[model samples]
Target: MAEPTMRALLRRRDLGLRLVSEEDALPADALDRPLRWVHSSDLADPTPFLSEDLALLTTGTQFDGLDGADGYTGYVQRLSGRGVLGLGFGTEVHRSGIPDELVSACAASGMPLFEVPYRTPFIAVARAHSEAIAAEAYARRSWALDTQRALALAALRPRGLDATLAELGRRLGVWAGMFDATGALQSSHPQEAIAPEVLALLGDRVIDVLTRGLEAGQSLAIGAHPFMLFTVGRGGQLRGVIALAIDALDPEARTVVTSVIAMAGLALEQSEQLARSRRRLHTQLLSSLQTDDPALARRVLGSIPPAPVVVAVAADAPVGPLSDWWERLRAEGGAASFVAESPEGVVMCVSADDEGLLDQAAERFGIRIGISEPESYSAFSRAHSQALAALRQESSGAYRYADTVGASILSALATDEARLVAESRLAPLRDHDTSTGADLERSLRTWLEHDARAEPAAAALGVHRHTLRSRIAQAGALLAMDLSTFPARAEAWTLLQTARD
Candidate 1:
């Protein structure tokens, strides 16, 4: 015969029975078996004999008389508070019937109490509860199988990565995210807060789970956020992990998590296979930059990335929105690849597949971008190392982008040179401009700062109209640089940025 659900177990032949017990029943489900036996006796609290193994069965036995059952309420109350499941009472044992006090407490505390007539055997009741639970298990298992099959089918479809992720999320009823081993978000639930750190951590968790051979459906919470982590493999080889997160999920959601991980692993495996050539190209490109062997490097880099490239290193903390910043970059017609340096830094490899896009990104990224020349892909090593040096050499938090040839030259402390030369050349003027009386220097700085706007700069400096104007010209002469020309102004700005400690 099929088992029954808990709801069915609670609705047996008892009615209006006192259930002043089971106040502490733990909210747990039996994975293997439903509860079976219950015993009811007139004993003063037959609780002492049975320990952890058996649940207590009770009835209004010896409690009617003060001689043996005095203050029986406390005994039942304590047993119920200790998490005893159901309390039983025989109606004929005492004409008074089950205690109303016990039943009321049980309901308030979420515990169930059962009443029994002399004809209903406690053993029979236990059998009914066990049978009910078995039925629920069968039903859940059947549902899981159906959901799994549906998810596996969708995952095998030929949707793009974005489409696939969206589909996977819908099927799973939670947010789905995929990130590379390095933690860069390859795809995430659209418009989500999948940051670089979160992406990397998800990858790490997947590897850890698979390496440990954790059971597939096991889940745990991270911080306040809940996640289902899976060790995924594709085409018979493991690729990366996928994280499914949300508050408590329904059974359908849980099933999708399991199926999607399996399918996504296969998808990723196939993708890597299909992308072997592109990956090789990327590797070759990066390799060309890493080495000093020009003959070998140039051969590998070839004529790819016909446009120039630039490298940028995070000198301090990253500022503003990375997506917005990176999107503006893509709009510039450049290809952007990101890698984690550590918690402390990030690096961006920027190249103009189309120079216009690169220009647009530069304008919108709003960070001091560095520029580099059209070195073969093999030149990445040299570029990255040089970029790091440039990062350190420049102001700690300023942005540095390699400029075509200018980047390699400026980045190389040796052949590049000039940080010192630029600093030295501009120092006398720096000092002279500094001592121009606080009022004068302030006025000059404001004027230069506001593009020499007489009124606006004057308003900012809080100086009289004429005082602000005179200081601007005198300050420019002292600095030995015209305050007007684009080049002079740019050089001055660079000097200021470069000289800043």
Candidate 2:
């Protein structure tokens, strides 16, 4: 249904209205212009009271005092220029019939003129228009309520947004499409009907929408087609955009579009909420695994891969693509693969045999990965250390597996325990050096580094072999450690590594 237009009002012949202008003067298309309200003003300059698309009725009371054709012509021209739908001249109150000058002026200016006989009061036309307007408004309200109900039902369907958008497009008799904030097309109905030009138009408008921060709906032209765009959210949030192809949207169609925007915005919000919840869970699980809390990690993740797990850490990796990698890992490694995002990079624990899988992924995604040797769940912390060590050694942007035996001793203690052991064992030496400014600990460290070779140890210390040996003997005496024993040498080396770890 259409709004109350001039053509619709003119069809009511009960008031006996007559068109005084040339029959062809009123264009058929112009008759459909919407009529806001019926207004009657006798003031010569009633432009202030009148607005566009209104039919102005007059009695010529003010015109009776004016001079000849110029006054009447100027009067008609003023009404026409003010964009009134038409001028209604009421006869017998002031004039007997329509003035010839006014008729000619109306024709020249393309303004439709009508005559109201003595029997027909200006109030009669106003009353008829008022009733027609009320009827149209009622019809529109009824249509709007019906459309809203239909949209609500569509939104509740099992398919959710897809069915809702399809229903909208069906109702509007056009193709409808939705796009997320990333300019990715989420969905579209009757995909074949989505012309390339329409997508291009939306692309162009997106730039404008982002730059100008447009939150309201915008009606644009795509070639000869009409396109209506509405932001799915408010306050510049831009949850998404809904676009439909239609020449002109009536009140009923606009009502449907608005309902779609509301539902779509709600759906988008819910989707984001779910994603955030999953991300929080993933982060929690990652924290537990990274902190070497295997029990907590298993509890948080709900399950753990079977023993001999291969842990890997990546450096400078893109987090956005990690989600995709996780899903891919689940496909390839099934229940044996697990991935999580860490602050430094992404971390993963897969079956030891899946080392080749990590290598393939790193190559495919152009990322560097560091893999640990086969280790049980009890050694997850050790595996992480190996992975980190391997990561530090990586410089070729390729995956590197940890040298199991070379770093195995360091992995025996988790990072924190190693730090404690190093601090406790080296405490006496550290305190003595702090007070006396001695090089006893440094000398022992140099000797151990050179495999107890006095010549190299002396060269490394920049001292004579005798002096180096003397410092070592002094360090052993101060700590009550036997420097000549294998157990003592091993303990010293382990302490040295912990201090560095």
Clash counts for the predictions, in order? 33, 0
Q: Tens-digit lDDT track for model 1 on 1-501?
A: 233423345556453233334524524442112344444556766666544323455666555554433265566566656555555666664655666655555455445555666666666766656556566667767766766665556555666545566776775556777654323345677536555566556666765665565545447665666776555663324455566676555565566665666566667666656555544454454444456333553465453333255555553423323333453344565455432233324445555444344344444333433333334445665666656555554442333434323554424533234567666756666676567534444555466678867888778867777877677666677677787787876666555444533
For all candidates in order, the CA lDDT equals: 0.54, 0.76
Clashing pairs in 2: none
Best by lDDT: 2
- List the candidates' TM-scores in order: 0.49, 0.58
Residues 317-393 of candidate 2: C-alpha lDDT, one tens digit per residue: 75444544455347565545676677757787877766677776676457888888888876777788778777766
In model 2, the worst 10-residue window by lDDT is 319-328
lDDT of 1 at 333: 59
